[model samples]
Target: MSEGTEPSSSSLALLHHHHHHPQQQQTPPPPPPPPPSTASPSVAGAIVRGYRKGNWTLHETLILITAKRLDDERRAGGSSSSAHCSPSASTPAAAVPRSAEQRWKWVENYCWRNGCLRSQNQCNDKWDNLLRDYKKVRGYEARVAAAHAGELPSYWAMERHERKERNLPTNLAAEVFEALTDVLGRRAARRANAAATPVSTLPPAPIPLSPPRFPQPPVIPTAPPPLPEPAAAAAPPTLPPGHPSASGTLCSPIDITRIHLEMSSDSSESENDDGAGTAEPEAKRQRLGSSVVRSATVLARTLLACEEKREQRHRELVELEERRLRLEEERTEMRRQGFAGLISAVNSLSGAIHALVADYRNGNHR
Candidate 1:
């Protein structure tokens, strides 16, 4: 063969290796899971003579749960896609059905269509058991979170109080409730959020430090002008002493002093009226000032109370932060100690191996 026809060293090496070792066989994949059982309950069935009988498969349980959730959404008049019920992104339904039997029937129909083929009674019983287990798991999870937050003592006390109120603790293992909480946890979360309200979220009462603005009172006159008096009739021109002035009258003399006294009485009565009018307005202004002062005092008290509550909450927050920092420091110290012990252990193990090797070498020499 010519130089150009010669095989490369790398290709020749691969050929030789392949020739020395036969091709390895590929491995087969694992077998598929068994299909769902279609057998009905019988005397010899594992149901133990009770309708609860056979254990529900994971597939069947999921179908029942999904169907019930869909029915709930339907009742709520909400539009939700089937993908929402998938394990990766399961969401809470909008609402639960008010009619139990109707909800169960719908669940049964859905399960049947999806190849689960379970009776309404079976669906109802299984769901109830699942829900009860879900609650137990959730309660246990709450205790774990509380423990991590250093609140286990308070959490345990609360549980004891609940027991005294006739609420019993669950005995079932939390493992049995796995996969359940992942799907139903959102519903419980929604309910809790809806019920909970913090004091801080409340709107504060508006305080008006300054008194409310009132329309200014009109300026009142201290004294009113005197009332007009009737004018005295001019005495008949002194006609000849007794001439014709007494022609048809008995000549009665005009009393000038009586007229002056009557005019004086009218003027004094008008002055009294002006004085009463002035006093009335002054009394009204005094009443308005008193009421304004009372309102301002009440507002000041309310503002003080709000300030006290804010201070208390701030102090509590600071204390909590101190506790968290202390816990973090303790954890760091523990980690450092653990690492030191690990290093010491490795050194001791290396020394022991060296000692064993030395002993073996000495034995061979002997």
Candidate 2:
């Protein structure tokens, strides 16, 4: 073919390469960047309904209130969550049944938004269970006392004392009154009307009988007995005012029964005093035990959360390490392929140049 008609060797070589490789079609665009992992608002809203959220029992509710009160105490002491706080990005629920933690949170929110409550006792759930728990504790205390005394402690008196000290009757009365007020509005009026009603329908009392007069012989008044002769005065031995023998003190009392009764009464008073004295200590011990239990619970939860966080971080680190090693291997493979392609292209160009030179040399010789 003529030089003008045929394409140049270099150009033909480039055309051959393009025809074989064709530039690498553009790479799919990279998967669209993975959809966000969060749930849609509409779906979340549908899941949070009546039965979905757990129920709040009476005791649980009471505990929630106590927890709320504690939170208030903490907040009022100037601790705040503001530094790390951020508005939640998640969609709001229409209504969610609360877990224990959520219930406490709700209680805190309510307490903070509304002013102080009138009374904790306003929760008039029958405290029979609470009373039973209290009694159980008392029994445990009695057993402890018995163990300490090396004999069974008489719990009857202690129980009576506990009843009054705990004001169980007062609590019951208050609960009953509150219930009545709720069921019967204007209980006072009913009570007053009942009091005003007459008792005239009852049977009358019996009449008293008059004593019969008895006849007795009249006797003349006798003269008083002559006074006994005065004995010689003897000086009493001097003794201290509090001395056992002071002021003619006798060794034995004339009335043993009276003395015994007085002694018993004194002993009873001492026992009462001892009971009262020990009560405050027992209360302090119980409070300390409760605080310890709460602290242990909080610590356990904190430790568990920390452990979960650590494991998550570890998993992320492992993933990152895996990704890095994979990328390193891919980069090394890409370099190897690029180097191989460069060498192949150079070799093709050299061959094309050599052929053109050989063809020129042959044409000149001819």
On lDDT, the leading prediction is 1
Residues 21-126 of candidate 2: C-alpha lDDT, one tens digit per residue: 6644334444444442244533543454222124334434454345444544444232223212343522222134235544444454453244423222322222
- How high is the CA lDDT of each candidate model? 0.51, 0.41
Each prediction's RMSD to truth: 37.5, 40.2
Per-residue CA lDDT of model 1 for 85-113, tens digit only, reads: 55444344334324787667778768877
* Number of the predicted model whose TM-score against the real structure is largest: 1
Clashing pairs in 1: 47-53
Question: Could you tell me every candidate's TM-score relative to the true structure?
Answer: 0.27, 0.25
| Model 2 TM-score relative to the real fold | 0.25
Candidate 2 regions exceeding 4 Å error are: 1-273
